[model samples]
Target: MSTTTSPSKHLLELQGVHTHIGAYHILHGVDLVVPRGELTLLLGRNGAGKTTTLRTIMGLWQASQGSLRFDGRDISRLHTPQIAGLNIAYVPENMGIFADLTVKENMLLAARQARTVAQIDEARLQWIFGLFPAVQKFWNHPAGKLSGGQKQMLAVSRAIVEPRQLLIIDEPSKGLAPVMINNMIDAFAQLKASGVTILLVEQNIHFAKRLGDSVAVMDNGRVVHAGRMAELAADEALQRSLLGLAL
Candidate 1:
């Protein structure tokens, strides 16, 4: 006889989470969930505490109160590096690429298991190149020299340099041309199909609706609505009420 264990339905969960930045309370009891192998979108207007929530989850900002659980373990008290060590990757709104370094060097730095370019897994690197051709095209070029869309691609490619259990991305499609945004949407769809859980803070309603399996709308530091993306996408009245615009 043999027995097997089952994985948790939710890969990441934040319950009643609160955060304060120098006496300014940000997250007001944020409750969000990222289901295993699904893409969850965090949507809201400016100053809605969307980025703050992502920062808190990544341990960049400590949650003053409440619980954050990752794969059934408490992570509210963990430090930034420690949280990242659990195979979680975060790409902030700024993209966070090393501008001074060559694209190849930046990628090499992201690969923890590889000390040199030659040591990186060839197959995986090729797969990333396929996902973002600009990263390959600018392999030896300084990251700062690339266009905005290229930089965003490089940032995402760097995050997936090694296998990640979860990806927390902030506005991957920001400041891009329509063509580039569509390209990004395609890349993200492929990434979702590859089985990594994703949490995104996106202002692009089209991108969010296209790729999100679940949706959470935040306002004034609180999550005002949470449900299936399709349900929200189909309901214009609810969208206007929660997001102040129809999707």
Candidate 2:
């Protein structure tokens, strides 16, 4: 098993974050760090506040307490658009695709600075196509016609339509077949190779074990464990104790 004291550099950091949805409190003093150029996995059982933490980071839900920092700048109170403008991309579990639109149109919509496909960087589009062949195959087709896995690919493609510093994705492998999950894992590996920081909320142990550089496990709205993924994967007892299953 491998271990480290801490990351050398953090691209994103959350300190004591708390969230409230109406009268109910969700997150409580949640602390997480996404190291530069590394994939950080956020894992927990159902209703563990994993999704709420992601939403809070994206400004979809306002944090009632604590500080959020991206690249050394404070962003605790920023709205969604302003936060997105900082070159961070988020893909929720729903995949957030426009069902009525063509895949090409959907990509165009995510490219905020581009009005047409021609305006998007050709090399970047080619790279995205390489990462997700399904996206390229269904480029001109209505998003609604694609299967669940295909829609997830389109969602990730849209998130990377423009170059981004950080990619925050929720459950990329959720409900996918083994083959589809492998494809998603490969795509994420390539994205990591390109040096984009990533924070992922994932339940699939295989997916997380294969791709995660660092891990944070949450329970009842707070982080309970933080360490190298390799260490967690190597220790079955730790896995069972924290995740209730061995990887």
Candidate 3:
């Protein structure tokens, strides 16, 4: 019999997942679900295993126990490149841009099918430029010269250089000014509207509340809360209990 589950609403699901990094346990039975075509927010305090969960999903860290399912297929044993080949894009917290490369070079590298700038899909490139003008403005400039927020935009732009089934991002708004955060929020909103499932590890409650359709809160290496983002946003007590602060 096949190990893969039947099709369901969730694009990604982690059940009883446990991960260890060289004798140190990071995730303890973390259960998370990213519903198809919705933005899911993974929220928690520091050292709450959020990053570990993302890494495990990407196969950067192996799971000691349990299963990871993506699109009804078991991906628990897949390699990182194999996982990425399934049209899932991951943008790490550090933004993962090549500082030495020009902005255009960074984007070209992400487009697996394109060998040159002229080969890249013009419409898609234009759409990305619309989402982040700085990308176009600094196309010839080295990625290292861009501002923090610009770099974050470039990272996300690179992730969507080609179409993707899911986008996994870690803290897109971290260290961004309020104006840049708002811009990022708007870009994400458009991305969501265009029908891409997103699983984001976010520290900004306001950003989470605004963009998240589903929310999962991790605590002590496990999911303590899972439900609609509106419910979590409206409940101050629950917010305090799960996140230690009001949203």
| Candidate 3, residue 168: how far the Cα is off, in Å | 0.1
Ranking by lDDT: 3, 1, 2
Evaluation by lDDT, superior candidate among 1 and 2: 1
Error of 2 at 152 (Å): 0.4
Clashes of each: 0, 0, 0
For residue 11, give model 2's deviation from the true position in Å: 0.7
* Model 3: per-residue Cα lDDT over 1-247, one tens digit each: 6696567999999999999999899899999999999999999999999999999999999999999999999999999999999999999999999999999999999999999999999999999999999999999999999999999999999999999999999999999999999999999999999999999999987799899999999999999999999999999999998888998
lDDT of each: 0.96, 0.95, 0.96
Candidate 1: residue pairs that collide: none
What is the per-residue lDDT of model 1 for residues 70-144, given as tens digits with 9 covering 90 to 100? Answer: 999899999999999999999999999999999999999999999999999999999999999999999999999
Query: Could you estimate the TM-score for every candidate?
Result: 0.98, 0.96, 0.97
Candidate 2 Cα errors over 4 Å, as ranges: 1-8
| lDDT, candidate 2, 1-247, per-residue tens | 9986653499999999999999999999999999999999999989999999999999999999999999888899999999999999999999999999999999999999899899999899999999899889999999999999999999999999898999999999988999999999999999999989999999999999899999999999999999999999999999999989888
The list of candidate 1 runs beyond 4 A from truth reads 1-5
Candidate number with greatest lDDT: 3
| Model 3: residues with Cα > 4 Å off, grouped in runs | 1-6
Could you arrange the candidates by TM-score from highest to lowest? 1, 3, 2
